[model samples]
Target chain A: MEKLKYALFTGCTAKQSTPEQMMSTMAVANKLGIELVELTEASCCGASHLQDYDDFLSLVLNARNIAYAEKHGLTMVTICNTCQLNTAMTKHRLDNNEELKAKVNEKLAEVGLEYKGTSPVTHFLYAIIDDFGLDKLKEMVVTPLSQFNIAPFYGCHNIRPSELQNETHKSAENPYNPTSLDDLIIACGGMNVDYDEKNKCCGFHAELQSPHTAAALTGNAIAGAMDNNADWMVTPCPLCHLKLDTQADHASEAIGREVELPVLHMQQMVGLALGCTPAELGLKHHVTKVDFV
Target chain B: MSTEHKITTQNVNFKVFRFNADEDYLPYYEDYNMEVTSEEVVLDILNRIKWDHDGSFSYRRSCRHGICGACAIKVNGRSTLACKESMNDMIDLFGNELTIEPLSKKRAIKDMIIDKADFWDKHAAVQPYLVAEIDEAPTSENLVSPEEENALDDADLCIQCGACHYACPAVEHNEDFFGPAAFAAAYRFSADVRDHSETRLADVNEEKQGVWDCVKCFECAEACPKEINPIGKITKLHQMAFQEGIAKNNVAVRHAVGFKKSIVKNGVLDEGGLVLYSEGPAIVKHIPVALKMFSKGKIVPPWGITKSENLDEIKKLVKSSSTAKF
Candidate 1:
C-alpha cells in the first residue's frame, strides 16, 4: 500500500505487441504512487507452447520469470492472463516442494541465478483492485463512465484452477460469475452490465491453428455483449483485447453481422477515468476506435 | 404471519437451440417468452415451451432436480444443467434473455439434445468401475476409512454430467482428449483404494489424447455444476502418472520440457533446437506451420544462437531442476 513497487513482467504478447496495456498499466500504477519496475531478460511464460513440450520446462520458464523479480527483490506483476497463470502455477509448485526448489535452484545457479522463492506473481487486475482500493480508485476518477454500459470480460486463465489464487484472488467465488472487473467499472462510474458470454473465451489461442473456429468464438462473445446493449467492453487479457478489437472485422464476417463493437483494456479504462488522453493511454495505437473511452 | 410480496416474472425469454435430424436444415435459435414463475428452473421454461409454445419442440430431461444431469446444455455458451441453474440466478447475472444451445464440442441431435456416444466412450475408456487393487478379494465389504472417504469425498458427487467435457478447450481442439468429466471419473476410481491403477494410469498417458493435452484452461472446474473441480482431478492424474512411471515420448511432454532447456541455454526459446530436440523426426511435417508463423513475425531468426543476458543463471536453473530425460 505504501508506494508498492513491482517488477512488471509484461509477457511477450503485451511487451512485443500490446504496448498500450503496459504503458497504461504503468501510468495508472504511477498515478496511484506505485512504481512499475521492469522485469527484463525473462523468457516467455510458455502459454500453450511450452506446455506442449514438457510440463517441467514450463515450470522452469515460469520460475525463470519469477527469478527475475526475485533478483530485484520485488513481486512480479503481469497484465497477460496466460503469463499470470503459468507463473502463479510455477510459484505454487515450487512453494510446496523444497526438493523441486533445490533442483530448480541448482539449474538456476549455473546462470548465476538462484530461485530464492521470494516473489509472488500478481495479475495487474488484482494488483490494482487490492493495492489501489476501490475507494481510492473512485476518488482518483476525473471522468465518470456511467453513460457507457461496459461488459467486463474476465477471460479463462487469470481467475481459475484454484492453485493460482493468491491473497487478492479467491477461487471460492464461482469462476463463471466474474465480478472483479465490475469493481473497476463501478469505480470509474461506469455501468458494469452483464452479458451472456461474460466469461466465454475469446478464442485467441484457438485462432493460431483454426482462424474460422476462433472467429466464430470471438463473434459469439461480441454478439452476446451486443445483445445486452453494451456500449463497449473491457477485458483484462491482451489476447482477448486482440480478438475482441483487431479481429472484429473477421468476427463480424463469421457471425454474418457488423461486429464493430469496441473493446478496451482494464488499464485503458482506468486511464480514461484518471483523465489520461488517447495518446497518453495509447488508444490511438489500437485497432478499435476511441469512441467510448 | 408474514406480509410478503407476490413472486412475478418480468418478460423472461428463452432462446433454445432447435435442431431436428429428421429435417434437412441447419440448427437455429427459436425464442419463446414465458409467463410468471418466480422460482422456475431453465428446464421448467423449456417444458413450458414444449407444452404451450410448440408440441414439436423436443429436448431431454429425466429429473426436475439436478441429479440426473440429463438437461445439460450451453446456457450462454457455458455447459450447464437447466434443472440445476435457477431463473432467479440467471436473471441476476444475465437478465431475462437466455440463450441455450446443445453443448459445444458435441453434435446436436435434435433441439437441445446432443449425441452422448463419444462422451460415454471417453468416460468408459477411463475405466470408471472399481475393483480391488490386489488379486485377493476382500473378505467383507471393503469399507473405506472416514479419512480416506474424506479424501475422495468431492469425487463422490460426480453425476456423470458431461458439462466439463463441453466446457474444456482441450476437448474442443482434440476429440480424443480424455476430457474433464472423464478425468474426474477416472480419479474417483483410482483414489478408491480398491481400484487397480496400473491400467487406469496407462489410460491417462494416452499420446496427446490424455492429461497432457489439457491447457489448464480451468473452464472445466468453472462450468462444473456439482462443484466437482475436474481440473483438480486432472492435476492429481498428472501426479499419479508421474509416480507410476507411465511415460511416453509425446509432443506435450517433449515440448514442455525442451522449451525450458532451450530457454536455459538461450535467453528465449531456441527455435531451431526446440523443433530438432522436441519434434525430432516430426519437425519436417510441421515446417509449413512454422513458415506461416515465421511470415507473421511470430517466430524471428538468429534461431538458437541468441544468447540471454543471464547465461549463468539460465544454465543453473536448467541443470539443477529434477527433469526426467525421456
Candidate 2:
C-alpha cells in the first residue's frame, strides 16, 4: 500500500477549545501509518464567521490555506467541519470562477503565495473512508469497540450544503441519510445507534446569538442520541464536540434533566479501537469524563 | 397510454403521519401498502391513498407540478415537493419502504398537512413585496437592469413552499427566528435595485430573531425544491448589513468582525478575545464556563499562545482583500 500523507488543517477548536481532538487525531494517524504534515503556517479557515463579515477576505484566507497544501503537493485534511466547508467552498469557487481566481491570486501574489487550485480539501472523516479503506481499518483494529453503542453526529458542515461536498468528494455521503460515520462506527466494531438529530446542527454558530436556543439545540441532539440508547456520542467536528461536551450542563437545563452523555472526537473513537490508552488519546481533557474508557 | 413506455410496478410501504387536531391528542403513523408505477411521483401515491384507500387522508396539493409549492412534505426525512419527487428517484434513494411525514418544525393539521399560519406570518414580517417609490402606475417597461435581474435569479425562484423554512434548525430551536423563506423573501425585495425600501434591512436586523439567528447549517439550501439557496441569501443579508452600516453594535456582527481582526493580527482566531470582544461586559456570564475549561486544560492564556509564522503574509492578504469586492 502507498503511504497516506496529508496537510493536516486543525481548525481553531481542536487547537484551542478542544485540544484533545488534535491529540487523538495525531495518535490515530501514527498508529495507522499516515504521515500528517501540520499546516502550521496556514491561518484559520475563517470558520464561517469571517465569511459573514467579509466574504472576499474569507475567500483569500482559505485560498492561502489551500495554497500551503499546493506547496506541499498534498491534499488538505481538516478535522473541523466548518474549516472543511469554508476551505472547500473557496477551492470550488476559485476553480470554477476565472475572475474570482484572478482576484484571489492577485492577493496571494502579494503574500508570496499563489493559489493554483491544485489542492482538494476534505474532512478527516472522509479521508479515513476514502483514502484509508474501511476494510483495512477493520483489519488494524486491535481492541474492537464491540461493547459500546455509539451515535455518529454528522454535524452540518461535514455533509450539508451538498453542492460543494459533492464537488469535493466523488462518493460524498448523502446529506439526507449520511452513513459514513455509521460505517466508521461499524468498522471499529461498535454498534450504530440511529437517531433523528444525528445529522443536525450542534448550535455552535448560534452560541453568541441566542444562548438559550444554542443550548436547546445542543440538548436536543444529545437527548435524541441518549433517548435512542446510545452509550456515547461521537462527532467529526471539534466545534460540535466542544458544544456537546462543554455546554452539556447548560444543555441539560434546556432539556430539564441532568444529561451527561460523553462525547468523543471521531479520531478518539478510532484511537480506542486501535488499542490506544484513554490518557494517550487525551480523554482526560474532556469536560464530560470518559468513564467508559 | 403509450405502449413504447415500459410499465414497471413495485409494492411500496408508505407510513404516513396521521393526526387530526379536533380528534387525536397524539399523532401516529398509518401504513398504506400499494403497488405504484415506476413513472409516478409522490403526489400520485398520495392521491391514490386519499382516493382509493381512505377518503379522510388529507394533504395539500395544486398545479400538480413543482410550482405553487403546496405539495411540500417530508419524504424519507427530507423536505421536498411531493409533486416534483419522482417515484423511481425516491425508491433509489430510499428503499420501497418510505415513511412520509409533515414538514418538520410545523404543527400537523392532518396527515401530511402542516399548519402554515406561523410560516406565512413570519413571511409577512419581512414584507415580501416590492416597495418601489413610484409616483404613478408605470407603463409597460423593464424597470430593472439585466445585471440586476440576473442577481435576483435564486431569490425569485422561491415558490413559498415553506420547505426551507421548516427544514431550518434555527426555527426548530427558536420561534423568533424569521425562518429561511422569510430571509429569502427579504433578500428578494431588499436586493432589488428598483425597490427603495429603507426599512427592509432594518426589519430583518433584529438582534436574535433576524439574520444573525441563522445557524449556517445549509439545510435550507438542501430542502428547497427550487434550489433557492436561502442560506446563501441570508449570508448576503449579513454582508448587506455590514455594507449598509446596519446593526454595527449587534453581538453577532461584533463576533463576525472579531474573526477578521483576529485573522489579520495573528493569522488565527483569538477565541478568548473573540468572546470578550463580542460579548463585551456580557463576558462576565461566561466566567464559570471559562474557568471550567481552564481547569480542564482546554484553554490557555492569550500571552502563552504562539502567533502564526506567516503573519506578515496574512496581514498583507487581509489588507489587499479589504479593498476588493466579493
Best by DockQ: 2
Q: For residues B1-326, write the lDDT of model 2, one tens digit per residue.
A: 66688879999999988889889988998899989888899999899989998899999999987999999999888998999999988888888899999995249888788889889999998889988777576677746678888887579989999999898888887888999999999999988987878888988988756999888889999999999899999998998888887755868888888888788778878889889989999999899888888889989667766667778888888887883222
lDDT of 2 by residue, A182-256 (tens): 999999999999999999888999898788888988999999999999999999998999899899889999879
lDDT of 1 by residue, B1-326 (tens): 39876787768777777888788378777887776467778788878888988898877899777898888887767677889887788777666787878785247778877788888999989888885555476577767888887777498798977888887766775677778899888889888876765688777767646776665667888788898988778766765665566656655456555656666666555555665776678677656545543443334444424365666655665566544444
Model 2 misses residue A78 by how many Å? 0.7
**Runs in model 2 lying further than 4 Å from the true structure:** B1-5, B137-142, B323-326
Q: C-alpha displacement of B290 in model 1, angstroms?
A: 13
Q: Write the per-residue lDDT of candidate 1 for residues A8-39, one digit (tens) a residue.
A: 88776554346678778877887778888876
TM-score between model 1 and native = 0.68
How far out, in Å, is residue B188 in model 2? Answer: 0.6
Q: Model 1 - which docking category?
A: acceptable
- Which numbered prediction scores highest in lDDT against the true structure? 2
TM-score of chain B of 1: 0.80
